[model samples]
Every structure is written in C-alpha cells, then in structure tokens.
Target: MPHTRRDHAVVLGASMAGLLAARVLSESFGRVTVVERDALPVDVLATGSRHRRGVPQSRHVHVLLARGASILEDLFPGFVAEAEVAGARTTDALGQVRLLLSGQRLLQTDIGLRSLLCGRPLLENLVRARVRALDGVRFLERHDIVGLTATPDGRRVTGVRIHADGGEQETALDADLVLDATGRASRAPVWLHDLGHGRPTVDTVQVGLAYATRTYRLPQGAMGKDQLILNNATPENQRAAVLAEQENGLARLTLAGMLGDRPPLDPKAFDAFAASLHFPDIFEAIRDAEPLDDPVGFQYPANVRHRYERMRSFPDGFLVLGDAVSAFNPVYGQGMTSAAMQAEAMRAVLADDRDARNGKPLTWRRYFQAIAKAVNPPWQISAGGDLAFPDVRGRRTPAVRMINAYLPKVHAAAAHDVDMSVAFIRVGSLMDRPESLLRPDIIFRVLRGPGRRHPRG
Candidate 1:
C-alpha cells in the first residue's frame, strides 16, 4: 500500500454527496467528520419534510438516474432494497417510463437498468442512515464551515473553520485530508484564492429553466406501477411536464419550461400550463389526484463547472468533489449520478497502491487531474443539451452544431429501436460518455432508422 493514510477526512456538506463521500473516506481513513449546516432529521421517516435551508432545491422533484441507483446500490448495498421494502418502485427504465423524446415515444427495450423513484429528501434520509452506520464517521451538526484553515507554504489544507455552537470558533480539527463535498453553493474557490492559490477557471452554460411542482395523493391502485409520464418541449413550445409517483404514495408533478416560458405558481394556472405541453398525460393524471399542498417553484440559471484540474496551484490534503466541482441542470437529472461517480472515483484512487493516485499530499495539479477525468464527461453531457436551444447562449462551434444535428436523429431512432434506445439512455444517464453512443452500429442505425416505435398519445 502507498504510504499516505489519512487520519481523518473533513467533508463540508452532509446531504447526498456529503454523506456518500464521508462513507468512502471512512474506508480509507481512520476517522471521518462531516460538517453540515442544517440539523439532520430526528425521525428516520421518509416523510416530506420542509426543505432544508442549505438545499434550496429540496422542494423540487429529484429522482435517481439509473446509473445513480446502481452506484448507490454498490456503495451501500441493500440501500435500494431497503427503499424497495419501504415502497420505492424499482421499475425497468425503458419499459415503465413513458418518455416523449423531442416529440416521439422512445422505443421500449430491456435495458436492464432500473430507476428508484423517491423524492430528494427520502433518498437523502436513506443515505444519511447508511453513512451514520459506519463507526469511522461522525457528523457535527449545525456546524457551518466558514473557511479553510491552511498552513503556511500554502501547500496543504489541514482543517476547516466553522461557526458552531461554540460561537466564532477557531478550533482546528486535524486531518490527513480535507474533502470539499459541499454542494453547489460551496465557498471552496474563494477559500482557495485566499490561501494564495490562483482561482480555478469556471465554465457556465445558462439554461434559465424554472419549475413549479406540487405533491398529490396517488390513487391506491396506481401505487405499484412505475408512474412516470414525461412530456418533452418542442422547439416552438418551450415547456415540459414531468409526473412521477414517489415512495410515500405521493405523486409529484413538475411543470418545467425554459427561457421566458415559466409555469405560474398559482393553482389556477397549473392545469392551463400543463395542458399546453406536447403531451397531457401528466395533466390528466393530476386532474383527479388529491392536491397535498400549494405549488412550489425552483429556478435554476446555469450549469457551473470549475476547471480545478487545469489550475496551476492547489494545496495538498485538499480536494473538492461533487457540486463544488460541477453542478448540472436538475432538469437533466445528473447531479446525484455525477456525485456518486465522484465518490467512486475518490474511492478507487484511495484503493490504488501507487503514487500516481494520492500519496504524500497530492499536488494541486495531480489532484484535479484525477477529478477532471470524472467531471469532464458529465460537463459535456449536460452542456451539450443546454446549448441545443437557440435561446440558450454559449460557444456553439461547428462540432456543436454537428452534434445538435445528429442528436435529434439519434434521439428519433432511439424512440423505437431497442439497442439504440438503451445506448442513448445510457449516455444520457451519464453511466457512459456521450461518445459511447457513437458506436458504428448505433451510427448506421440512426442514419437509417427502423420504423414503428411505440406510439404515445
């Protein structure tokens, strides 16, 4: 084994990514500490708790991508099984989900990938419980991390400064490594600059998407079937409707639109907006479904990516992962998948018995290089879609335009053909890179598609 064994790893956030990272760290390090800003749930029930102030999008609908469910299952075995026992529906992706892609129904196939349907809070609660079971980790609740505590030479990050119950505390908790598993709103970049490290280059692609979602009580007979009715936005009509049944017998309907096309939060406008989409299954589903609460809205501006891998200087014993490194559009459903991959990447690096991974404090370059391998694929995966719309602005090169042209045809082919369908969904889910869809077989099929995909109303 390589010589570097961390005494502890300090994680900034305790949500999905935070808890997963803490679990991974516990395996490699003797002890792990997660500093979370919000108070964790006292009762382990998967009830729809009010949104935590730390996670602004908790109120929005969050479903695990197929790859994310697989990763979570491997990282914490029987987690999905437990969720299944608790009422999460584990249904085949292609067979169960009714997806209208670009305007057509994606062809059904036995993709072997299953998605776990549950709200964001319930998924977080299950993961938090799993992480807490590890003896090597401890969560310091209500301890908000303010800044990084670094040593002189600016070569290493030893700990973090927090605002805890102790009040304006400057106490230093020593660690062999400090992990920034903090989500999108992390202060890592600013803290890096404060420690004499140059600022990491950032890439932003704004989609300007917004959503208005409200929960409804599902009809009892409807509980067993994987209830996902998705209507995609056509170029002319820039709105989509997504309806899914959660584990708690609650159905969530999120009306999503881009540019200036936002669904109003008023209950009166909800049905009207839902009816305006390409398909109206979701609207029909919720028409008689019992409304649990008034509509809640979430506005996301862009996908932010920090090119830490290309940065010139980074301290040892310090690395940023998850949303602090990249945050994608929730509309694409990639955050948790990318975060799981990031944690798996970290674990693999820790498992490697070589200096190429992490040794005596990885240099800023070496550290981010490892992370870039994980982040770049998902970045391109998300950005490619956002840049598709003429209204969404970004650097659209010839290759991008070429991709835009090809993607529609590929997507069209996927609507009916089985192999192409599974391949496209695999790439879209971030289990594989976008290039994975470019196999010769898929390309030829997209160029000349087999007709007769399953028709959607």
Candidate 2:
C-alpha cells in the first residue's frame, strides 16, 4: 500500500473525467472531494440511466473503446462484468459491429476487441458509483465553482471556493491539491491568467460539426445479428450516422454533418439524412422502427487543445485533465476514452512520486506532461481526419497530408484484408500506436489494394 501523501484533494466536475480523477486520487490523498454544479443521481442503479442537463450529448450513442474498457477494469476490477449486469451490451468489436470508413466496408473478423454499448448515463453512473464506494471519498453535488484559492505568493493552489446551488454564500474548501476536470468550457485558462500566469497555447481545428439524435424501439430482428452500425462520412458525402443498440431494448440513431451542414430534427428530414449516408444500413433498420423520442440536435464548433505542457510556469498543486485540456471531434468517439487514458496517466504519475514519503505534494508539471503524451495520438488521429475535408480550417502539414492520402488506401485494403482491418481497428481503439499502421507488411498490403471478396459473418 502507498502512503497517503496529501491530506485532501479536490476535483472539479463530476463527469467521467472528474469521477476517474477522484478514484485515482483516493489512493494518495487522505480525503478526496468532487464538486459538481448539477445534481447527481442518488441511486445510480435505479435512475442513473436517465439523461441529465449537464451532459447534453447523453442522447447520442457512446462506445467504450477496447483500450478504455481495459483501463477501467484495471482501475475498478470486474468493471466490464458489472456493466454487463447493468444491461450494457458486450459484443465482438469487429465481427458484430459494422464499420464503414471512407465509403469502404471493413471485412468482418474476430479481432479480439470488445465493444461495450450503453447510454452515456449508465456508464457515468457506474463509474460514479465506484468512486463513491471508495473510503474517504465524497461528492458535493449541486455546487457552483467560484474560483481557485492560492497561497499568499500565488505559487500553489491551496483549494477552491464553491457556492451551493440556490445558496447565497460561497464556501471555501481547503485542500493540498486541485484538479480541474470540467469539460470543453473549462475556465482554467482564464483562472491562470487572473493568477498572473501566462495562458497555455491553444490549438483549434474548426470542424463545424452538428448532430441530430433520436431513440427508437426496433422491430424483431431489425438489424439481423448486428449490434451496431457506423457509417462514417467522407469528403464526397460530408455526412455520417450511427445506429447503436442500447440497454432496455432501445436503439439510438445519431445523424451527423460537417461544415455548417446540419441534420434536421423533423422526423422525415432526419430519416432522409440517415438515408443519404454512404450506406443504407442505418436507414433501413430504422425506417419502420417505433419512435421513442423527438430528435435532439448538438453543434460542436471546433476541436480545441490547450498546450499546457508548453507553458513556461505553472502553480504547484494545480492540474487539468480530460476535455479541459483537449476536446476532440465526437464522430471519432474518442472523448470518453481519451479521458480514461488521461486518468490512467494521472494514476501512473501519482504512483511514481517518490517524494511523497517526504510529504511533498504531487508534481503537477509531471502530471500535465504525462497527459499531454496521452492526448497527442488521439488528437492527431481525430484532427487529421477532420483536416481531410477540404472545408475544415487548419494547417495541413506534409505529415498530415501524407497520412490523409494513405488512409483511403488503407481503408480500401481493409475491406477485404482481415489483418489490415484488425490493425486499423487496433489503432482506432488506441490499443496500438498510429505508427503501427505504417509497418512494412501493412504498407505492402495497402499498396496492393483490396483483394477479392471475403465471407463476412
């Protein structure tokens, strides 16, 4: 067992990132407190699956990448089994889910990857429950974060100030460390500026992404044996759709478009958008399905990355993780998984703090550096994909250009090559680095192009 290095640690936000941070912090801190502005579900097992205001994308389909599931299992043992017990669907990643990239259908095969299909609420609740069960961990739900509380010299963060929802006065909570896990709209940069520290460099890729999502109850044998269908958009189409099987016999279909093209909320127009996807699988499955809810829309302006590691100076006992550091295009389904990976990075950094025995606080600089390494690959993958569209605004460096040009060929070859398909999926799931896709053997297959048809299960 590791010795407790800090008396208390405070985590901002109660989302996946915040919950994961609290879980990891409990090991090194004597007490961990998570503060959130929204009211959390009291009985996660009973009403946890219902959507909340904070997570606007709750209505959309969410997939737990294989790499992320493995990390969660490591952090909280039997996480996969527990999620299954909570009505989440587990299926062979390649064999059961249809993947279409750049208008090419990847051949089905048992790639040894697992896909966990469940509503975002259910997944967050499960994680929140695990964090809540930890000793000396507590939640301060329905509270608004006021600001950071620093030492006299402003060299270290002492804690945070927060106001209870509907309360008149703000309360100060003292801690040895403060971690900001607030999502895309994080105010950490502004806070740092106020504290007389230079803001981190910001990188933005304007994707102008929009989504329209709806729920339905499909008829018996609607998709035959398939559990999920993802038809990604290409520059030629500029539209995408995903129909995923969720718990409670529900199917959630989310239609997406890029570059100011928005999917409609009108029932007929929504179907028309799905029908116009590269493939008709999603449209065909939901054509006669029973409507469960009205379509909802979400717009994402850009993918933003705060280059905190490049900042010359940062206060001690203060750190940022998750979407607060980088927000990616949702079409890639990398947000939650990226947060999980960042949490794992935080865990590793905390565990490696040899100075903890001397009562030294965590090295925030090291933590940020570790998470930057963790976020780089996924950010590049998603950003590179967005840049493939002629309309997206960003610097298309030679490296990005080369990779973008090669991806189409890779996708084409993966249509019939099982090894090629598995390799692509592994990289997409973050199981392996993107460089693995450039191996000599994989390159050879790409050069040869797709082969004759193969039987698909």
Candidate 3:
C-alpha cells in the first residue's frame, strides 16, 4: 500500500475521467471533491439509457473495450457484473461482433476476449454511482469552474473558483492537488496562460469525420446470432457503419463518413447511407426494424493531443488527464479506456512518491511521460488509420507507410485465419500492443493470405 499524501484533492468534471481520477485520489487523499457543471441523474438505473447534455456523442453506439472493462473493474470491483445487471450486454469479442477491418470480415472464432455493449449514459452512471459511494469522495454538481487559483509566483496551484448553478457569487475551494478532466472542452490551457504559463503545444490529425446514429427496437431474437456488426472505413471506402445490440431488444446504429461526407438525419436517408457502405449486414438487419428515435449526428474535425510532456515546465499541484490531455478519434472507442489507463498511471506515480512530503509534489513531467507512453499505441492505430485516407493530411513516415500497406493484407488474411483475427481483435481492443499484430508468424500469414478475395462493394 502507498502512503497517504494530501488532506484534500479536487477533480474538475464528473465525466468518466474525472470519476476515475476521484476514485484514485480517494486512496491517497483524506477528501476528494468532484465538481461538475451538469447535474447527475437521481436514479440512473431506473431512468434507463439517455444522453447527457455535456457528452454530445453519447447518443451514438459505444462498446467498452476489453482492456477498458478490466481497468474499470480494477477500480471498482464487480463493475462488469453490476453494469450487466444494469442493462449491459456481454459477449465474446470475436464470437459476437462481426468486424470488417479494411473492408474484410474477420473469421468468427472464440478469441476468449469479452466486451460489454451498452449506452454511454448507462456506463457513466454506473461508474459515477460507484465513485460517489466511495468513503472519501463527494460530488459538487451544477457548478461551473471559473479558473485555477494559484500562488503569487504562479508556480503552484492552490485551488479553484467555481460558480454554482443559479448562484450569484462564486465560491472558492482549496485542495492540495487538482486534476483537470473536463475533457475536450477543457480550459486548462487558458487557465495556465492566465497564471503566466505557456500552454502545451498541440498535435492534430484532421479527418473532418462526421457520423449519425439512432436507436431502434427489434423483435426479440430478431438480431439472432450476431450481437454487433461493424465495417471500418478504409482508404478504398472512407465510410463506416456499426450496429450494436443493446439490452431491452434495442440496437444502436452509427454511420460514419470522412472528409466532409456527413450522414443525413432523415430515417430513410440514414438507411440509404447504411446500405451505401461496403457492408450490407447492418442495413439488412435494421431496414425493416422499428425506429425508436430520429437520427442524430456528431462531427469530429480532428484528433488532438496536448503535448504536456513536451513542455519544459508545469505548475505544481496541477495535472491534466483524459481528453484534456489527448482526444482520440471516437471511431476507435479509446477515450474511456485511455482515461482509465491514465488513472492507473497516476496511481502508480502517486504510489511511488515517497518524497512527496516537505511541500514537494510528484513531478508532472515524469507523469506526463508515462501518459504519453500509454497514449501512443491507440493514437498510432487510430490516427495512423485515419491518415490512410488520402484526404486526411498528416506526416507519414516509412514505418507508417509500411504498416498501412500491410494492413489491407492483414485484414484479408484475418477474413480466413482465426488466429490472425484474434491478434487483430486483441490489438484493436487495447488488450495488446500493435507489435503483437506484427509478429513474424502473423506477417508471413498476411503475406501469404491463402484465402484472400477481392474487395466487396
């Protein structure tokens, strides 16, 4: 067990990242306060699945990657079982999800990997409820963060100023440590600038991706056999679609387009768009299905990464986690998992800080370095995959070029090879690194590709 540090810590945002941060902080701090602008639902389990105002993309389909589920379970014991009891559907990763990678369907196999499919709001509610139940954790919802409070030298952060919902005056809350987990809209950079510190440089990959989604009610056992169907957008076809089976005989379908190609909101147009994709399974399944809601759309211009690790200096008692540090392409489904991994990294660094006494703090540079390592695999996979599309602009080195070239072949081989498919799923689910997919044996199989077939329209 690690030694306890600080009397109090404040986590900005009640999102997944913030909740995870608060969970970890509870272990080391006497008191941990989570401040959020949005009001949490009173009875999330009874309320069922619904989108939160703060998370615009929650209306779409979301699947918790295997690695992410493990991390969440580590933070909250029996998380998967509890979430399953709350309406999450569990299935073997490859056995249930019909994955089309680079336009080729992976062969069905029992990869032994598992995934929990459900609505984003339900998952967040579960995690939030667990975090709120912790001994040292408390929530201050319906409050807006004004800015970070800092010392005269601007070298260390002391606390934050917040405006409560419908309140005239802002309140000050002090803490020994502060974590910024406000996600993509985070104003941490602006707050740092206000404190006379330079904001971290940002790296971006512009894909101009847009997607639309809607929920549908299906007859019991109508989905039959396959719980999920996905066709990832490839260079040959820069459009993708995914249909995931949720609890209560409902399914969520998401259609993605690239380089200014947006999915329409009309139901007929949405069905037509799904049909237009390389895969027909999604359209076939949902064409005659009952539409529960109108199609909703979301746009992502680019995947952004704040290079905090590259910055030479950082204020004490201040750190950024989750989308505030790096926001990945949503198509990859790495956000929550990546945030959980970052929290794990923070836990490790905090645990190692024996010299955190005498007013000294854990070094942000070292922590950011650890985070950069954790973010690299997913970033390379998602951003590199996006860069495969000719219209997306980014620097591609020889290794990236080589990987992109071999990826199509890999997908082709996975169509017929169960072992190859398992390797691909493992890497995609963040359970293993990209290197696992590039082993000599897998490379040979990809190169040989005995059962390879032509592309399907």
Candidate 4:
C-alpha cells in the first residue's frame, strides 16, 4: 500500500537517536531537519576524529552490542563493513573479550556473539555521514531548540522554535512531526508544562557512576590473545574497568567507580586504580603502554526514565525517544544500544500503520507505547542490576531480589559452562529477554555449579 507522505519532519539533536530517527523519518517526510545545538564537526567524514562538546561522554569507551550492530546494518547497509574499513574492530563478543562477572572469569570460548569496537566519535561520524547523505534529510547545525510552537489551544505541536548558536534570532521551523532526541538534558517536559500539558512521570535510580578513560598505543602484538578486557564491580567491590582495542592499534582503558568514588586523573594514580581491580589483566597489559592522552573523567549521577507512556494526554505531532526518554548507567554500556532500539521502535510503529500518519493524537500515544515496551528489558537489566549495589538507592521488588540473587549463580556457572556463558551474554546484548535466564535448563545448570575451579591471585 502506498502511504501518505508528510511535508516536513524535524529531529532534535544529531546524536545516535536523532540520526537514526532522521533516517527513519526520511522515508515518510519530504524534508527532515535535524536541529543540533553544537556545530557539526568538519572532519566527520574525512578523518572521523572530531568530537562535539555537547556529547562529553564520547571521550570514553563505547561498544555496539550484537543487537545494535544488527540494527545499524539494517538501517544503513554495509555499516559494519564500512566501519571496519575505517578502523573499527570487530570480534566475536564471547571469543575475543575476557569477561569477568561476579568475580568469576568466563572461560575462553567462541560463542558467535560479535561486537563492534570503536571510539564514539568515529562511530558517530560514520552514522552522521550516512544520515547526511540521505535525501530530504538536512542537518541544521548550530541550532538550539528553545520550545515548541503549538496550536492556539495547545492540542498539537505545530513546529519548534530554534535559536541559532550565539544569535539573537529565534526562528520557527514548521513540521509535521517533532522528535526530541536531545538526550538526558531534554527540555520537552518543561516545554510541555509551559504549553499547559501535564509533565510525564519520571523514575530515577541514583547510581553516582564515574569513569576515567585514557588512550594508549600498545606495543606491537602486545594485546595478543584478547581484543578487550572487562571486569565489573561486585557488591563487595565498587570498582570496575574495561580495556578496549580501538582503531589504528590504539586502545582505551576506562576505569569506573560508584557512589562518589572516582578514578584519579594522575597517570600514576590511574595505574594504581587499574592495578586495584579484582582482575589484573587490564593493568598488566597497559601499565607500560605508551600513553596517547591524559586520563579524562565523566560522571553520571543517576539513571532516569521519563514515563511518557503513562501520560494521560500528550500533544499530537510531538514525540521523544533515545536518551531523552531513558538514560541508563553507562557501566552497562546500554545507552547507544537502547537508543538504537528506540529508533527501531519508531521505525516499526511508523511502518506498521499507514493511518497513523494522519497527524492524529493517537498516533503519538501508540508510538510512545511501543517505545515503552522496547525500553522495558534494558531498563530491567540496568536498573535492576544497579539495585544489586547496596549504595544505589532504588525499590527492590521481589523479582529484583530473586534476579539479583540468582545472577551470581549464573555468573559462577558461566565461568566454565559454555551454555551458561552464552545465555548471560545473550541477555546482556539485548538479543534475548531477561526471562531467558530463568528457564529451567539454565536454572538447573547454575545450581549444578561451575564445572571446574581455577586459582586466583
């Protein structure tokens, strides 16, 4: 069936969610304007070396999980291949990465889980190039969204008022739809209140997560056996770290701390922090590596979710997705993947019903409902996992308690059993639902215990 085409659509922010949303919206709108407050990096296509100050976390490590990789490929054909050519490294998630969970190291094995490792700037550049080239998609850089223009009665959003960076003029760009992908600092709630609509309910989990990352040039073939190393903080130990292989023989080591604990910026202190991890592989490999940059730190105060699905009334022609909708604890590395999932949800909801394109109020509600469904699992994994840390304040339901209690068993079993490891990775990657961990077979294996014992230092 031929669907109706809209005149124009606007996406706020050019981050992952905004880029993905523009890609999806291009199919149904004649023109899609992406409004970004930060100036677009000039070398995004040529070098993939530039970063926008708006995205401070881009300085740290980021991974495209199995599902996000698949989605990006679907949205932009040859994405992985192009990324690889641009120096992004691909390795089987379970094969090349040393994973330690709950103090137990996963036995080295290939389980067919693939991950795309690269700096966030490089990945963003690739996606930005692809999206910029899409017909009818225009990048409106240096524009900040001030508020939405609405119908006289405030029943529908008509357009958005945007101010050019450092300019006195605020202009209105009319559109059939307005999507807020501006991330955690989204002003949609305030805009809604000013427009007389009730604000969406918000849920928050305080994590107080902090990270310090440094890039280094490894000695040739020094990171021989493994491409990545990860050690997660347990309830007993609130420190974590990951050393990820990046492009051009460069690697990034990100040390993480919780509840106000922070990795030091001094090189010696950072090395000591790495040495203090429960697992020493990261420190042993990077202690003598050539440093390319100083250790930089970023802080995440809490994980937030705007419960738009439960809103009694929302304006038509308005929608919010991506980190604007939910920002998870970065320790889980779920932000990019969650944004991709929300973009995918937008695509699904947009494609499934042609009638929904009529600019009706129900259409936005339906899309928010779908986004809520997509967010549930990752929310459960991140928010639920955060509860495991006693310092993190949250409501721990019976289900949360049960899952937390049983997860250590799963981690212990995964140290040696391939099936258990696979199950855990699958859930972590969002390829499978969290309930998959509760299946009888997995439960039986976890209770049966890890198959062997290995000495620890």
lDDT of each: 0.78, 0.88, 0.85, 0.87
TM-score of 1: 0.93
**Tens digits of lDDT, candidate 1, 61-180:** 777888889999998988888988766777677667777777766766556788877777777887888898899899898887878877887777878878886676556677778888
Q: What is residue 55's positional error in candidate 4, in angstroms? A: 0.6
Stretches off by above 4 angstroms in model 2 are 1-5, 355-362
Ranking of all candidate structures by their lDDT, best first = 2, 4, 3, 1
lDDT of 3 by residue, 229-348 (tens): 888998777889888988776899999999999999988888889999887778888878899899999999999999889887678888899999999888888888899889998888
Q: Please, what is the TM-score per model?
A: 0.93, 0.97, 0.95, 0.95
TM-score attained by model 3: 0.95
Model 4 Cα lDDT, one tens digit per residue, 1-457: 1123378899999999999999998987889999999888756546565668889999899988888998999999999999999999987877787887799888666767678999999999999999989999999999888899999888788899999888889999988888999999999999888778889999898989989999999877665678888899999888999889988879999999999999999999999999999987888889779999999999999989999988887788889989999999887788889899988988887777655555553366788889999999899999999999987988899999999999988888888787787789889889999999999988988999756553211
Q: Root-mean-square deviation of each candidate, in angstroms?
A: 2.7, 2.1, 3.0, 2.8
lDDT of 2 by residue, 246-304 (tens): 88888899999999999999999998899988888889999999998899999999999
> In model 4, how large is the Cα lDDT of residue 211?
95
How many steric clashes does model 1 contain? 2
